[model samples]
Target chain A: MALGLALALLALVLALVLAVAWRGTGLALGPADWAAVRFSLVQAGLSALVSTVLAIPVARALARRRFPGRGALITLMGAPFLLPAVVAVLGLLAIFGRSGLLNRGLEALGLPTVSIYGLHGVVLAHVFLNLPLAVRMILQGWLAIPSERLRLAGSLGFGPSEVFRHLEAPMLREVLPGALVVIMVVCLTSFAVVLTLGGGPAATTIELAIYQAVRFDFDLGRAAGLAGVQLAIGGVAALAAWGLYRPTGFGAGLDRRLEVAAPAGWRLWGDGLVLGAVTLFLTLPLLAVLLRGLPGLAELPAQVLPAALRSVLVALVSTVIATALALTLALESARRPRGLIEAAVTLPLATSGLVLGTGLFLLVQPLATPMVLALPVTVLVNTALSLPYLYRVLLPETRALQADYGRLAESLSLSGWSRLRWLVLPRLARPLGFGAGLAAALSMGDLGVIALFAGEGQATLPLVVGQLAGAYRMEAAAAAALLLVTLSFALFWAFDAGGRRAAA
Target chain B: MLQLDHLTHAQGDFRLTADWSANPGDRIAVIGPSGAGKSTLLAVIAGFLAPTGGAVRWKGHDLGPVAPGQRPVTILFQDQNLFPHLTVAQNLGLGLRPDLRLSPAEQARVEEALARVGLAGLGQRKPAQLSGGQAGRAALARALLRARPVLLLDEPFAALGPALRAEMLALVREVADQTGALVLMVTHDPEDARALGGETVFVGDGRANPPVETGTLLANPPQALQDYLGRK
Candidate 1:
């Protein structure tokens, strides 16, 4: 029944999005639209290349070296991946925006001041968000390298370069392509990041083009055409990436520190410098946001409180729906391995939120004002979007439960609600918490759907921050960005912490 | 009587046959060569697996089509006898109510069962808090509280020391004697078979021969039994 419900929901999204996309079918790409498409490819390709290449050194340093706070640092790496794009953009701008600390320092040093809003800024934000993801993914590959192989290398008196050639190179080769492809697909749907940084016609991405087509141009037909292009591009990438998502080795994966022999001299210094620089690059903007937002916390924008409340409500509602849906869908799929339903739940991974919102706009414009229904639609879409991660988290866990104790439970006559409450729920509390945390944080931090859905004064916090930053209200924008970051991390930490305590 | 009437189980190229019955309260230890159908035979009777061609009758009732829980039998696997996440009381209470919604009277019964297994005043502690031997006792307490007509033990205490195994077997014997429930325990340990002191079934070469008096079977062992015990 849950499978049926989940399939029905997925079918609804696909039907609506496709119907609108197919409403007026012509592959006409105007120069501006072509530029958007070309820019999307160029930026995503460059971002994927730079993030994966840069991650090699950081992940290598991490795998062979165990310093204090190393575990916490690795955990913190996940922050940017889940960090709301609007908040991250603001953080970057706090340091790299026109009068941000970077320009200020450059002026003091008599160097040319560099602005952050442009192609480089967009690429920089992409790398900042995805570099940690790539590092974590490649580090998992390095960790997966059997300790015996490293020991063999050491026994053969192989130094770092030889070791890389003999062992690490092949592992990286196997893992890097999938990581690059996944990040590329993710960036293809990039909207908020590009919207905040990439200004003017030339720098626009296909996703931002779709947004402009609907909002500025009011040309639903062109918007629908761009959406199809996005669907085709993102779908192909996602399909190619379907069977290759073994990064970071999440959820119950025990990544033990391997005792690979560390090289002395030049290599050690090089690794140290790499680690220090990467840490600063990743964390300084965040620190700036915190430092800047603290002063403005007292004199917050009058509208922030209500927007914060609205954001919370949206997150809470979406989290409940996603968790319930994941539990039920996971339970059903556990009994019978329904690959199609699993695929349907994860289909949103390939979707662009702007495309979906545009389709929804087209679907409803004739009947009702899209603005009036924005928040509810945002909640529903966010819930649907979150289903994939939550579903992935729950399915394997529920299957393991059934495998380990299904027979015992059956023989004990522990069926129906009793079986679920006693056996299933208690056993699943940890993954359940983690999945819920993922859902809540993702929903809280998601500026994409709300950007499309929110109308007039119904703006969510991320939207409000983006607006503030755009309007040059840096103090309030920083404060709001800080609030957005805090809300996301706090929700995640609470649920994750709750799960640990319960499981303990 | 719990009866296995010409039961046959097949998986891939392996097949096991059992034609055996034990009267109520009969204690039987199933012994076999490696990969023989000792556990398979028990599984067939426990309703975990269906026989290719046979019926398991408890008293006069055909238990072939019944679910494992609905059947008048309970089985303890090699591990996971108690849910580690559940408290000792909740683990024991599952025997009474799967929902764990115990009445005061049922609650008293759970406490008494806990005491009966030598785990008195430890019902609130979790399985992880208990020692290995104590966990075994807690599992036995649940089995005792379950009080089904038949109890199938699949080397549930194989990890325990020999002294502990003997003690557990003695406790199992006493519990079975008190409840008048038939017991079938599968063990690879030869001393466990002898110390268990029951009618023994020697399963080998795709067949489980009928249970015979333990002392007689050991005194003049069958070829397969000699092959197993002769290893010493």
Candidate 2:
């Protein structure tokens, strides 16, 4: 009953917002809107295509070859996908920004410096965050092609290129579209990467445009107008993707204990070099961020700690709300089995955080006691924003629980609270904890809600870091960024470890 | 102990209708071809499936409305019989009380059950650390701890070697005998039926044959059972 009420409320509010945005301010696609839309699509397309193309070789190598640190490498590939986006942006900036290490080294070498503040910068950051994700997804695809097939190819005296042509190419063809679509969806809703690296009109995305329309101009009409456009574009993409999407069991039992034949000659060297270079490119930026931030840590004072505390508190609240919402939605879907509602729960993935923040601002600002509801509203917005990821993490596990234990629990007369406590909760503990931890970490690193709703006294850690970065307080920003990363990692580690221990 | 009356369930084009009853302490092995709704029958009785037309009664009470976990029943699936992340002790303990807040005697009971399964002192090990036979034993230990009136097995040991399958089957029979629980198992192999030595329920064409003594059924097999087993 409570779940129904929550779902109704969510649906009603979302519907009302959509109606207002639709009728009150019909989508007026001006030249700026057109540019933003086109640029966003182009950028997302390029990011997806590049990420998918690059991930293919890496995924193939990881799937078909083995060596020392193979397990660690596979594990490492999963890390960047989970790392807080803002932290990744900060790390990338510390390495690739104008005054960052790369430019400095280039200057020393008497070469022209590269600017990490344009389309290329946006693409770089997108690739940096998403390449590993694409690789992991595609690697699971490669691994899914039964090892026996590959062994048969080997037994047939197939050379490396022929094997690649027959086995690897088909696998790539099958996996690439899905990986690209997922990446495209990710890039469509991107806010932090564009906000950080995308400078001037040339690189601006629809999400950033939404932020500017609301925060800078306070023009709800234009913001709403752009939001309509955003929704239409996103809705169309989502619909198309949904139509094309085959629900492949990407991660199920892919971790088979299998042996592979060793690569020979240049094949070995080439794979090794590609793997090493990609690893270096991905890890060096974070290392640079850590190194640059260490000296600046001394400059951070008591104020930063309280701001960090505030961030953690807000994150905790948002995480709990988001997890609860996700769990309720997952369980409800399991019971009721609505495909569209399940897809709608993931609609936030297509809507940018900046757009969400804009919607919240427009929704709340007209209220008489908006000030009193600020913190709760902020947390709620964060929860809604992080809802997609929480759903992604929880839904699979929830479905698995339903598949495995639903029968047993039903036979035993367990239902409602008792059933949840005895059967669902115990089995779902690990995934629930993981999802909650992910929500918390994502919320902690989020700057979107704070950008609009946060008062002078309401700054989160990400907001503080953004402020410092905007004001050219690079060192202080670095310190706060590092602190934020550490805090996020610590929260995730604690929750994950706790879940494991509880399961044990 | 359990009764299913005119149980009919249809999904897409497939339909299953079985009317069956089992007395307390009866062990019935359900044997059939793939897609013969052998597992589906167990699932319906276990309350996992709500039949389109039927009624289920357990212990002379209508079980149509009872949820699976609270219906004095337990199911052990093929391989996911034990939660992987949990230690053997924790898995056994969960069968007692999911919260693991057992009384001292209850804890002792779990420990004793673990020992009976030959998993004593290895209760701290996770499912990943266990061999195939050991995991099956651990699953049996969990069922022992549950002490439920009905034990449902969906080919839990079918993947194990013949020796191991026999050992697990014997262990299950032993445990069921001790608890006096009604056991309904689904299997594809005739050898499993021979080892189990229970009443046989052959399901085909969406209907289940009446329960027959295993030895007699094997010695003078019905045409349907012969056809199914021979095809396999």
Candidate 3:
């Protein structure tokens, strides 16, 4: 059944790609199409480069230092993964917008005010979203360096520069390329960030261009063409990232504190500076979101509440589908450990939300009005988009469970729901809960497919925030963004806490 | 009778063949060198691996269509006999009903099995809370509750200390005697085979020879068995 489900997902994605190719065959690529492609590559490249480069010092500092709240700060880095893209944009704008805090401070100092717009703004948003991920990735690399090796280095009297050359630089060389490629692939098919922060002909990504071609121009053929471009880029990049990727051993090091060579004097101050600046860079925007949104909370626009409810519904439905699909795929793959199952599970990473939405739009446009299918399509696309992450999280636990107890359960006449209830569920409750929480939070904050499908009546909260932000209703947008983030977090916490409790 | 009718099995480059039968309530010790298909032989009998060229039969009927769980077989692996997350009682209860919707009588049986295995009051403790000996006893308690006709032991008590393992082996013998089940235990030690005090099946060089009396085989071993016993 799990293999069949995986094959069905694979076939669905393939058929959609074929449909896009078939629809787009007769259309000629325009200058704007090519420009969107170029801008997508450039911004993604810049975003990945900046995020990874900025991560090095911060990750190094985090790896070597042991202090109060270090673990909490490391935990905080995971918060952005659940934070809504629209909320992040609102927060960034609050700090760096024309009449915002940064500009106001600059004006008071009689300095030139910086604009948070165009290519830079888009990269800033991407960096804000992905820098935490890059730090975590690189930090995992640092932590994975054996304590014995560090102790050996200390005995050799190797100073900071020597340690860098032999120990740190080599680890970075091994890890950095994979991190860069993963981040780049993530940024390539970015729809929400691009939709809100990047637009106009020069800054448009293929994802945004597809949305425009459908929503503004009513050009299905052009949308298909853009979708085709997106599928190709996203597919290739995702495959590359998959090939380059290593597990990074992300969660194992939280409690296993490493005592590396902690150089004194200026190095101590330097580490402190790096930690302080990165914390501010990460936290200030979140602080700005809370401060800016708190006053507007009581007076949120009328559409905001309905949108929040719709988003929560979408989140819940998608979480169920994604978690079930992930569990099935994970169980089957763990039992068999097949490469094809992995390809099917990871297929979603290669197919972006907008691409799935566009294909669904094209398919549904013929049968009925696409507007009426908005929420369903949103749910389907969200399930597809989040399946890979959930599957990744669940697969290891499932594999471990199968290895340790599979035969014992089988020998006990434990099969079907009995095996699931008696053995698999209890053994796997922790990862299952975590992956479900992740899927729920991801779906809740999603702004991509919903934007493509939502008409005025069916808008999800993230879409409403985007619409508000687009209309320059900053106060209302901030409030809505706050509500969206709050709901996303609540869903995550409920699922995660529930899982931990069950496992206990 | 349990029959391995010209059973031939191959995995990758390794191969093993056995054409033997054991009567009801036989206690057989299968001893072999490492990687000599000792576990594979048990797996074929337990319906985990299909024999490449033969069939396993119980009483006069071929057991080819039987699922592992449906086979009158209870296997005890080296470790992980009990689910770590489950309480000792719940783990034992799984033997009576896979879904664990135990009736009051069945629940009483579970507690009785625990008492039988010397784990009477430890039923509420999770597997992680139990000591190694207690955990082994808990697993045995479940097998006692299962009361299947064939029990395959894949070195289940191999991690126990000498005294504990001897005690568990004695308990296993007692359980098999009470249940009137055939026992095929895989062990590396000749001492263990002697402790088991059953007819020995020497599995090595891709063939599992027919059973020999434990005293006779140890007294006058083949050159290969002698080499194996000497080397290890």
Sort by lDDT, best first: what order?
A: 3, 1, 2
lDDT top scorer: 3
Ranking of all predicted structures according to TM-score, beginning with the best and ending with the worst: 3, 1, 2
Q: What local lDDT does model 3 show for residue A487?
A: 95
Docking class of 3: high
Largest TM-score belongs to which candidate? 3
lDDT of 1 by residue, A95-120 (tens): 88899898999999999999787789
lDDT of 1 by residue, B1-232 (tens): 8888887899999899888789988888888877898888888888888888888888868887899988888898888888889999999999989999999999999999989889999999999999889998988888888899899999999898988888999999888987888989998876777777778888899998999988898888877788887743
Q: Per-prediction DockQ, in order?
A: 0.74, 0.31, 0.84
Residue pairs with backbone atoms closer than 3 Å in model 1 (clashes)? none
Calculate the i-RMS of every candidate, to one decimal place: 0.7, 3.8, 0.8
- Report the TM-score for the A-chain of model 3: 0.98
Stretches of model 1 off by over 4 angstroms after superposition: A24-31, A109-111, A247-258, B59-65, B230-232
Q: Write the per-residue lDDT of candidate 3 for residues A1-504, one digit (tens) a residue.
A: 887888898888777778888897778989989999999999999999999999999998888888999988898888898998889988889888888889999999999999888899999999999999999999988888888898898889899999999999999998999999999998998888888778888899999999999999999999999898888889889999988887643366565555554888998899999999989988998899898889999999999999899999999999999999899989998888877788887788988888888888888999999999999999988998898889889888888888888888888889999988978888888888889999999999998988888886899999999999999998888888889999999999999989999988
The TM-score of predicted model 1 comes to 0.94
